[model samples]
Target: MSENIQKKIEDLREELHQHNYNYYTLDEPTISDFEFDLKLKELQELEKNHPEFYDSNSPTLRVGGEITKNFPTVQHQFRMYSLDNSYDFNDLEDWEKRVQKALNKPVEFVAELKYDGASISILYENGKLKEAVTRGDGFQGDEITPNVKTVSEIPMQLHGDFPDRFFIRGEIYLTRKNFDKINKRREEEGLDPFMNPRNTASGSLKIQDSAEVRKRGLSAVLYQYISSEFPAKTHWELLQKAKSWGFHISEQAKLCKTLDEVKAFITHWDTARHQLGFDIDGIVIKVNDLSQQRSLGYTAKSPRWAMAYKFKAEKVETELEKVTYQVGRTGAITPVANLKPVLLAGTVVKRASLHNEDIIKKLGLHEHDFVFVEKGGEIIPKIVGVNLDKRNPENPEIQYIKTCPECGTELVKIEDQAIHFCPNELHCPPQVVGRMIHYVSRKALNIENLGQETIEQLYREKLVENPADFYALKKEQLLPLERMAEKSAQNIISGIEKSKEIPFEKVLYGIGIKHVGETVAKKLAKNFESIDE
Candidate 1:
């Protein structure tokens, strides 16, 4: 690669990096996906044709498209604690009594919206954004500062006075509007949409390229100041200060003086929560007085000063339109119920996972059958049971398919198994991609640079068909492909090489052998000496 090509690669990297920072952290994208991809492709093409000229900061490497053998732990500055939960009014009432007793007077509780998403801690120093980390098991978390910096609402610099080290806790959420749009785009592009907003938010945060994070449109809401120099006597006061600092704080907070008031606040939101734009699972109640909070202390998992008042799932009767089949990556054929679009748990429920063929037969479901659909775990809408009386004789009974939908392979039902599997593991295109994905999974070979989309691209391009073929990939072969750069290819090669020296157990697990899990693979590795053995 010539110096001119190297310079061009560096320039492209800087440009893409700037765009990603602007879009993700600033929430102000100036270019569309097509435009960004076009630029990335151009850079990739340049670096591919000249392997020596690849830049590490290029947008294509954001996925880290390389495998990570291990995730080194880092202890947190403060203990990342969990919140105590109260499922019933009785439990909540008891919690209020404890708070009142601790205070020795009438206590005012601050009730805020509880988000159903990934918890993150944002640290700032000298009014500039410093680090962002996940609440990993409440003790230590992965340093995702680079990825977290892309979140737009999380200010890179504080608005007011600078603090030495301030930690703020927030929920990273994907809005209903953005989620729908993302799914719609996925559908149009013939890709499976994300299972839920929580999954999407988690995946988006892990993207190595800061530019990719900007495109996902993730939002954050600061609820608690974990550690701050700014002193506040109550949770409500801390929220006010957070709002002043330009962090998005919950507006639905209510100050209640008694258990009755707290109950009223919870009850009001139970029905009215649907009006909110984002997904909120419950109300988080915190003791207003800081002294009482300190005295209450914490349990092993959750803090006693705080309790989540979860809303009950709303169930309604709806007609089962039909039952469909979805093939899993493992070739398991699971049934899905097609329901009449009905509002459930603040979202429209058109379909629900049916688990397996056994469930379909057990439900005795048929078309135009009146079925009671309940919001499973307050998220997924599931068919609880069918009202046989409402079943019309004119409608035909549901039947499971004998063949795989994609490859027309004969589906097999093994003994003692509920799911039907398509036995064409090696022949089926989906299965091939699935196997490749498993081999490159985090817990297996830990190939960090490989991604589902990239695998699909390789499959579509006929560059690879099996796990072994991945090892044969060369720098020249990757550079010519869209979005593949010299640096990206090298990174992937390095990641693949790192996988070779990993324990035999990981290699065994990566093969996706039937009846062999991580524990079994470890056992096999311990018995064997090498990967070949």
Candidate 2:
């Protein structure tokens, strides 16, 4: 690389790093969108020219950030679990009968609308909110206490004389009013709106900035207390007591005495649930008696005493308009099936992923063919199959692309893997950007203030070409950037310096290796003599 080009790269990383900290951690911005873009563009061009020298911790790999090889295992006080789901009244009745058989007596049931949002465990100690954790893998969750305290519904202090240490299980959700308002504003600003209230609510709660949490209007309603010492006799009674402790309890919860009553309650909500302001994917039916709940116990993944009745999949038939290949950050090219717009599951279903070339060929999917689509897990909807009977006589067989559209590079298929990859590496701008992002992510380098946009900005401005270049940055270099001030530049430098002292495992994960993740990286770190080793 030319001396000037290397110097330019160093200057860019410093500026971008400062911008990332300001926007992501501080929730403040010093630069304009256009200026940031210019910086990111420059960094990407330089990396493309010198692919061999690119560093792993560059700020380009944020989206599609892969899972760490493993998370440090955290065992819970009581087993964290999921709920068994039922769809309609018949299924609900079946569950009720099963519960009756398990209890071997007259069993009273507690019915509540299962909130379609993030599940969290709020910890209270001596009448104060001590910690808030995500129900991550039903074991341990990220400690998001700072962000959780910003939600108004989450009481700072407990109302009742609850035990010194207790856990309240609740679904944190965004209100319909807040959801619509945010979407409307995004639309006005020409930004893609949030898909659903549940996703937005979850994203809002998990954001690093507590100030951002305040603006999102997130709310939580307590459903159950996972306390070992609570003296509550029944599930319904426990919920009622939790309400007295100032938790936002569900108002529609009903205490059912018979299987018939459970069926009736399920049926009532099936029709009336959408009337509520927030989204609810299903209803939960729990054994009312606390003692019975304890006796029935938990399975590997969920509680045996309770089950959730999920709504049926809503599907629609649409024309297979076009199939496009999207290269993921990891360089995997996934085939996305674009469809003629058709309404399904309260939203328009336009495109679905074909997963891989095998799936496309298996379905014999061709452009303009009619296909049935349904939202799986109420999230991504893909083409179930093509109507071969409706195939046009004039149109030809659809062949998958053999090379990446962006770089004209031959796609590589790893042994025993379905996904095709573009081998361009640093030459591919998107992948370069993706790698940079992964390097600076929260769990990796943990540079608190960096974000996706700033990474893109740094790439455009030619400020940083690789992760190692970040270490060579100077504060004076950043002051010339559009929004950067001396103070902000110094903060970025400080964060970058602090990140250098992080464990080698984090640096390894930040590099965006194909199969290596945090857990595997940690294992490697423990065994290896040095980072290079």
Candidate 3:
């Protein structure tokens, strides 16, 4: 390894993530899509051969950023892990060679559909469902038992003969049919439809309201049999046993005896994936025998015996109508690409993110230009490049702005910062309201019924200015608002009063201090004990 392998990894990680944001989050890509994939390939190869450089938050993870601290965290008895990804057959072949070398024997692999969904860990005690947790950081996750129980497919009580205590890992997903229905309903109700089944499933799994999660129609299919006393020697046997115990294992899972068979399975799914009701991004190939998997062992972040072969993301073309800007809580002004509504990856996207001025300039974009869009991670729609051959000459070239959208103040671009900042944080309406909203967010004050709309209304009415004023709110004052009812006002005030007893970390997080989050707040609370200290 190079002396700067660690630095190489860090630099690659940063470069790849910058591209990912431009591609995925902003719908803008500074590099060609093929070049971007090559970068990911480089990073994955480095991480695979040298596991020590593995970073959990690597762009390769494309890890969900939907975590909220409202739910209690649960530590897993066995560490949950991610699988290494293989973009092509050669990568898969190389992985098998490594596994065979580790065990010094030919290996039979079991192939299963890699569902494009969220992962969950469920525990059973005495053959009864005990707890379910989101796979957070591969060790500790959020306990979402109540919400998980809403998924009708997951049996609350196991029926067949089974272990007294056991664990199961599964991919929680929303079927495409159900996802469309939900989206249609959302669109009819004038709410922005969900982006994809994977995100919808992830967001659903963490909901506090079981009834709402149930309506989301989420389902789970067991992917692994986990426990201190793992019984079956072969993975195939475990799947059959899990299915017999009322756990739904995907019918598409196949037992493969060789790498050729695994490739066949991958090829079969690549074309046939659209036929399946639920979205599947790739195929997972694992050593058939559990003993082989143990011997093959694991890296810091992924299983050595298993690897995921991802299908190429589908691409589409759409028209960019205009560019708009929005301000984040941190005061960074981000450019947004307002596109003529088009359906990609089963969701209608009215707009895609443009990231910043640099990304805008790189694409050489113009208003009303034709651009090609692709779901970069099969999660977010991004513009890889403009369709230059079809560029509209009549439309004007895209121009950058200098003023903050929330407040008409001149924006400041700090040295070494990619984003422009609004210096007028004190009076910017969006920043003020954004801060107030964050203070009462579920991860902070956790004030129930005080949503963004309510906070904005309170600010506009001058009924509340800062977070401290919330506790002092009078029910009489709330009644004068547009549609506030006597009971609603009482509930709001009651919820506000209840927040007074929240932990000191939560209070610190709610304080809206720059660079402070729940984790930082918790650290401060633990060391200081009191604010003065």
Candidate 4:
């Protein structure tokens, strides 16, 4: 209740807010990082002692992103739309012509980098963040506000925002630095490294634990202001206004007066885009005039006013060390190429998918052959061709894997599928262990303490055989297992107890059924009243 403390609190809030605005938006900060940190720490201490003085706008709210058990899907205020794609400049010219024909005049365009990450919609009600939504099916999305808050780049509370309702659209991306670090951590933990940043970013948002999402150190950038209570006249003006509101805005945006200028912009960044920290597949060209965009309207799937000028997949030559086959939970065998660790796109490439024996044979893939690899969809690395010039004629002809890699059984090829299948589903160690791992994965039963290694050990000892056996584990049984301490056993028991209360859909997913994913499981669970039926 002291006037001096209140004054100091108010002053610090204003100071920190202004500094953040300067640093994030304006790119000019009066205070150094340490000075700003000290002020923020002081304000946090004061707010801790006097909770009444704390407000939503306080900088401290940015760090403590909440944890939630699940993310409920929410309907978007505005139906999110994708942009029509263009692979070449001719397509861009044709698109520009369409815009001109629609508007009866030449159109100006704003060309910006198209980030290869999850598209997110953030709804700010009365200048406060309400929901961080995924672009699920365009009409509806999952509300991942808790996990989104963990991204410090995404401001929890906007600064100098006047909109009563703000519908902000942006990309939630993992930086190359963070992606590498995350993969390193995954490798250290004996987990397969994430294939790409975009998918990882997408998958991370849905994790039940927001704390894990925070540890991923996700980042975002605001490009299209999507919607707001206060409508802007032009795309450039909207971005400028968004910048002033303490949002992370990309500096690569440029307003072009003609199609030629737009082409020049795209041509300029085609090779230079690799310099950026984040993954960008192409440039998004949009009609700068908002009125023109509205008049141009939209197609069934995408906005006619905007076009994503996609770049060709970058390819590099790397020696194929060998081919490795993996057994899926469904017992389908997929061949993978072990490459001589080459750097592709923005990340390192140690291996690439061969897809099937058909691909391997078509490419004439042989041991110690020079192979040309490309990032399929600019996310996954794959061997596209065999460089015959560097291959030795004396090398043995390409011999595809004929038997199951794990089980000593002959692999069978289905009539239509190019993939080989291991028929030893009942006794194959990999199939059983893989199925068990899939059953307890995060999207299924979500058993916390039971990892793939533990599942394999249990399977080896014949302690558990089916999904139902997971629910029947005892403390005595766990006590006999290697590295299973009393506390660890109790935790596993607790985790299993918690998992039992999960909805029917999770149970359906946990059963390791063929052709049933999360969506299918949800549909099945909704259709069937009970499992016995």
What TM-score does candidate 2 get on C-alpha atoms?
0.59
Instruction: Report lDDT (CA) for all predictions.
Output: 0.77, 0.74, 0.80, 0.82
**lDDT for 336 (candidate 2):** 87
Model 4: residues with Cα > 4 Å off, grouped in runs:
2-10, 29-38, 159-161, 227-232, 317-351, 355-362, 368-370, 377-380, 387-394, 400-533
- Candidate 1 accuracy as TM-score: 0.65
Model 2, span 103-125: residue lDDT tens: 89778888889888898887778
| lDDT of predicted model 4 | 0.82
Tens-digit lDDT string for candidate 4 (168-199): 89999999899989977553323357888989
* Number of the top-ranking candidate, with lDDT as the measure: 4
> By summed lDDT, which 10 consecutive residues of candidate 1 come out lowest?
63-72
Query: Which candidate, 3 or 4, would have the higher lDDT against the true structure?
Result: 4
Residue 165 lDDT, candidate 2, scale 0-100: 84
Point out where model 2 deviates above 4 Å: 1-85, 93-110, 116-221, 224-238, 255-280, 286-308, 387-393, 446-451, 457-464, 468-505, 520-533
Clashing pairs in 3: 22-28, 26-353, 27-382, 27-383
TM-score per prediction, in order, is: 0.65, 0.59, 0.61, 0.70
lDDT per residue, candidate 1, 373-397, as tens digits? 8874423577888888888899888
Clashes of each: 11, 43, 4, 0
Residue 229 C-alpha lDDT in model 4: 35
